[model samples]
Target: MSGDLHTEWARLFAASLKDSGVGHAVISPGSRSTPLALALARVLPATVLHDERVAAFFALGQGRASGRPSVVLATSGTAPGHWLPAAMEAREAGIPLLLVSADRPWEVQEAQASQTVDQIRLFGAHARAFFDLGLPDAHPAALAAVPRIAAQAVLATRWPLAGAVHINARFRKPLEPLPTDRGEPWRPKLAAIAKAGAPRLFPPKPAPDPAAVAHLVEAVRANPRGVMVAGPLPALDAPAMRKAVARFVRASGYTLLAEATSQLRFGLEAVRPIGAFDALLRAPDLRAALRPDLAIEIGAPAVSAQWLAWISGAEAPRRIVLPGERPADPAGGAAAMLLGPIAALLEAAAVDLEAAPPGADTASAASCYAASWQAAEAAAWAAREAAAGPQDGPLHEHHVAPMLRSILQHGGTLMVGNSNPIRDLDHDVPPDAAPLEILHQRGAAGIDGLVSGTAGARTVLDGPLVLLTGDVALLHDAGGLAAAAAVGGPLAIVAVHNDGGRIFERLPLGRDAALADDCEMLFVASHGRAFDGLAATFGLGYARVETEEALRDAVAAALAGDRPVLIEARVVAGGSATRAALLAAMAKAAVAAVSAAK
Candidate 1:
């Protein structure tokens, strides 16, 4: 094998992304990616990130918390255009990212060099596949086509099977890389490109079409005024994808309406989870007597603007839309899509409606509005226990999502962020709180890599991360506070900081009188500054609080500390009189629990 051709194409592109498994690589500081960042920090598990758009949303939150694909590299004008908003938020949150970009030759861009352009398909169609390792060579069939072009850029970001891909390498000017026992004679081209894996997983989609799952199991067993909706679960806290979203709400006895970044709103066992359907779907006679005559939905379209305007202003329900990836119907009210693998099309529509078996469904069937969604979820958990029973009020920025879910306990990992902290944790959590492994970017729900996508999903979630944010999404991700002061642990941000744009005073152009002075100098851009001197110029650990019992003892001493803190609960948009007395006591106990529905 001819030696030192950019160190044998950066050691066969870091041994084909460590033989296609690719756990993490992020890197950023350039010099044409120093021999592909010193051969991915001499073979795998890399990190560096000196802000290339917070290292492409920190390798798209470690390819969305380790479902794999996290290489990201970068080096070449506009450092790969700051990874096109983390490749359009990993092509709208289906996750999985590879990116990589080093580039230079094509005769140094036909000699107009000095950092060339047209870095080949620079993330257009926000990449699902774009490989072009066209130059740097050593030729043992070009070092066995650089680990089968780094295993098809780790299998086109593993798109509906993963998401962003783009490889683009090019290198020429002796871009470092000579040592390592003189490329140990290209070590058997890393087992013939790690025996070409990953090209088959997604090519097998045809199975779920049995008459579009028997008309989605006869519109979910002829609706007892049906409803399922769930949204946001392209895999996280996978227990066989949360028992295929609890076997599609126990063989479609419906009444789920999940959200609160649905991991089916809690570790659902005997189903029927509504998580106070954003205050029991704000009753219009209990949403006109639980309206759904068959709804379905499933993934994405979360942060509910009144449950997407009550299923896009219902007049007809037969909706459908199973969407595991892309089919965000937006009010053309789905009608019918049901493609495939939403956990084997909801476990073959629960064995064609014989039901019971996923966590062995126990109850929730008799519906005529399940006693008006259990008395409007017990008058929306007693108006969220009288908005956390006063306890010396003052903390109500929508009571910090049930006070960060009562400062978490055994269950951890929660991010929230984007505007009014994910619409006040989709209207204060508790329609029986359980599934707590939350993360919300809601794909392209941009606050620009909020704290580097929760410090790259805090290296695959174990403990200590609770972000919650919104002092203008922590000042539009103050360069993701250098991964919250160089990633150690226990982040616990909780920042409600009302200095401006309190989610543009609940939109509609913040009560427009022809955009009240451009919604208060451009969308309530108030500057009461103070983030405890920006958490002492980012060495973190600051507090501020005021009441709601010192913001619940500064969130139980910032989740019993370890490092990076911040607290700041200083909210006081009192003009909205404690969010108009908790949305007028959860809209007068949602029409007095649907006029005391019997």
Candidate 2:
């Protein structure tokens, strides 16, 4: 075999990717991946990162933000292992990602060759599809097939469901672009095949079954008291889908319970979604009064424990789920599953509602039911505001969350970190705020890659990007700060330094007084370091703010600037206790307000 075979094959594969609409590539520096790296760089906008894990998550962010797959290139051995977490997230979250691992040739299999492991199916079930492209060959047929295989791999990432796809490429020595002993016999044929170009493929959007739509419409007519639960919907970020969802909610008259990451929560007051469901449901009376006869869920499962428990209870409503690619019924209690595009299904339901007549007095009852939810939602937000006291008093997640609205008033992306940050943002941020694009790693709900993911999202975002993260989550992906800087976009990171894992403090383990010392030592894992020094290390501007005004200024400045900035908001120790107390107060106030309204 000629040494130029691998380089030629790599060039053809990279060209195929470009033809298939892959615009960005994240390459982790390694020797085995040199050919592909050079080829991809020539055809696409490429970002090189030192850590494989950071590269993978960065690519994951791009996929999530752009709704397109970003190719991730890594060398053989454990280097590919670092991508497992991001790959799992991509699969679970339905984000398109293409993972290409460069491997040693067949002769070194199980022979203890350095950086050589069984590269076949490295990502396992986490990937939507896996292909082992055998070693580069000069054979006419083999050379001609490289472009087709590359096109197929890219298409697989989006087809059945948008998820990760793997391509294992084996290479011989002379991975560089240097000429070898063999002449360029196959070059002309390869160029001819490349000139033909692969077809541009798009994922098929299955229309909602007509029968299923009619059944659901009939159910809506019978069930006056219905709830539309909107969960984490990253796919609904597109304007067309968001508008479709709004139309369905306004036409159906079902009380909408929208999660923070649902993309339907912040705007669309004309639809009147119940954004305070988390706090309002905490009151038993409100929960009982708001129970519905039917529940329709879209997107992924919700993040609220109270909402989950309430929906899955023994007296729970009969559930209908519109699961896009995979079944999202976590409680395994869905009465009917409608598999189709969410936007299409919603639009169909809205159109069908005009034809279906409601049962006698059903319309009046539904109106009354929706009115009650709106009243409760208003009470919940008012009660929360009353209990939060003066925003200038102390720094907490509650204060930090409301500040986000002002930062993105003109419109931008808000990336919320997992654990307490997401919960706080969900609970406190008002539904009437300016329209913004919000993203979170709710697929796995882990706090591993917050920084890198934010950085990745920045690459594709048109406006400023802000990340709300805890100290522990920021520290977990500290290396990602380098990647963020390298990407060179406007990014502001608000690090809530409340010592450590304050999220654990809200769990049962955190409240065990008998094991107070152990709980603090093990569960919270308190770290006393500040983020200013870390910011300096990464050449990012830093600020430490203790008051609300200072935080507002810091965030505004960061967003206005062209470089990345890290703002540390020091939360008072035991901020979790403060938050818990606030929730309790809000719950009590909400019940009284509801009772008075009744």
Residue 455 displacement in candidate 1 (angstroms)? 5.5
What is the per-residue lDDT of model 1 for residues 1-598, given as tens digits with 9 covering 90 to 100? Answer: 2456676567667877777778888788889878888888877777787778888887787778767878878788778888788788788887888888888777667577787888888878888888887776544676666666676677667544567888888777667755555545555654454455322233344467788878887776666557777767743644565686576665555677777676666667676576667555555666777676777777776576767787677454668887765667777757788766677777787787764332223234434465577677767767767765564676667666776776674577788777677666766666443557777777778877777877788777776568888777787777777766777567777778778876676677776688778878887788878777777786878888866678777767766777778788886665344554665577678677778775
**Model 2: per-residue lDDT, tens digit, 383-409?**
788888788777767899888876687
Q: What is the lDDT of candidate 1?
A: 0.71
Best-fitting candidate, scored by lDDT: 2
Which candidate comes out best when scored by TM-score? 2
Looking at model 1, residue 150 earns an lDDT score of: 74
Please give the clash total of every predicted structure, in order.
6, 0
Once superposed on the true structure, which residue ranges of model 2 sit more than 4 Å away at CA? Answer: 180-183, 235-238, 357-360
Cα deviation at 32, candidate 1, in Å, is 16
